[model samples]
Target: MNRYMWIIVALSISPLSAIALSPEEKGLEIAKEMNRRDDGFGDFTATLEMTLKNKQGEESVRVVRNRTLEVPEDGDKSLIIFENPKVVKGTAFLSFTHKVENDDQWLFLPALKRVKRISSSNKSGSFMGSEFAYEDITSQEVEKYSYRWLRDEDYEGKPAYVVELDPVDPKSGYTRQLVWYDQKEYIPLKVDYYDRKNDLLKTLRYEGYRQYAEKHWRADRMTMINHQTGKETLLNWKEYRFKTGLSDSDFNKNSLKRAR
Candidate 1:
């Protein structure tokens, strides 16, 4: 064919000749889409019951109240207050998550009547002796990790996209994480956490999801199981109130002392 005719043929088949995206690019696209779908929440509050189980099957329960404020340009701010279990009553934790920087965290201990700052190196430590680390409690920003799309598979009978995440922060306790996101909702259904030694450490599963504000999906129950330690933590969330007019001041370090 003549050059002009060949050009015309190529244009006609452009759809089939589209360039394939690299795995990294595809993964980032998925993460961005997930973040986009979850944007504009403004603020929210919820009540949670945390159950901690030891290797010997002993269980301890604690009641907690949570408040979050969304920041459009940066990351979210959150506060967690412990209400039950007299030993831990009046304890509070405040977190300020950033899109590209290490999160700021503090804890208020009623006994000592002091607010202690949590260092970046200690973020990997367990939260109140639970299976979840301090870093795991912060708002997950897309910029916090690099991603790679692994594959599409079925999880709990739902179609899911499997993606691997490598934390951008070197201080992170986990080396990497594998997440299974619901294809339709763009929400994570399960996550496998790999320890710094690159061993499978824990698995987190989200269940009983309920929609709020007709757009936001909140998991009513989350269970984290530690494979090596044979420990488990279960969080049951309730009374989710969205757009409740939470302010930045409510999540500040000073607010930790006032948290009830």
Candidate 2:
């Protein structure tokens, strides 16, 4: 190759290729890249066993079914229905998440035979009395948070990107979140949530990741531990069925009432 061609090749392979990206720009790029990889599953269904543990270590478990439909221009739409626990049986939650705005959520109570809208201000509240806040359960749209790349580090024996994300919404429960994203898979392995007081509030860890369709990564287990309360929540996911012909109608408020 000629001298010019050699210079082009060297630039392409050099670390300086990324010199133009600021920390914020690099963080957004990473976030968008990860979102792109997770974009095309279309829809999926899964079974989840949620275990809630108190500070004293007492545990209670509930079984639920989850359905999610993709919305390309915005975030995803999801429906979750309780199945096993008698108290929560037939109860359902439906969420429509958006990229630049607050999410729309509703809960259906079988006993009351009514669907109650979840206020935007309540997004920080506990979801079903678990460690996961209502906002935590919603899709983590890239536009929902502003990000800054902290550093690259080793986490769980793997190279990971440490990024800090601050929620754009003033009403959000968390002041910021620090995520450890697996460098290879572009998947989040752990997240530390800070409360409005800027104190560490909860830590969430994702484990047992198994890929599907040769590209999509799904975590079989997710655990969240609350620092102040000493409580925790474990979610065991199973039977993930992707592209199951789910539709937008399957995620509406009426669907919540009709959810099985």
Among these predictions, the greatest lDDT belongs to 2
Q: Give one digit per residue, the lDDT tens place, for model 1 in 1-260.
A: 89999998878655324456677877887899888888999999999999999989999998989999999979898899988887788999888888887778788988889999977567688877899997787788899899999999999899999999999988899999999999999999999999999999999999999989998999999999999999999999989999998887788777789888
TM-score for candidate 2 = 0.91
What TM-score quantifies how close candidate 1 is to the native fold?
0.89
Worst 10 residues of 1 by lDDT: 12-21
Residue 242 in model 2: lDDT? 90
The local lDDT score (0 to 100) that residue 50 gets in candidate 1 is 90
TM-score against truth, every candidate: 0.89, 0.91
lDDT of each: 0.89, 0.90
Off by over 4 Å in 2: 1-17
lDDT tens digits, residues 1-260, model 2? Answer: 89999998888755336556788977888898899899898999999999999988899998999999999998899999999778779999888888887778788989989999977568798887899998898888988899999999999799999999999988899899999999988999999999999999999999999998777899999999999999999999999989999998788777788999
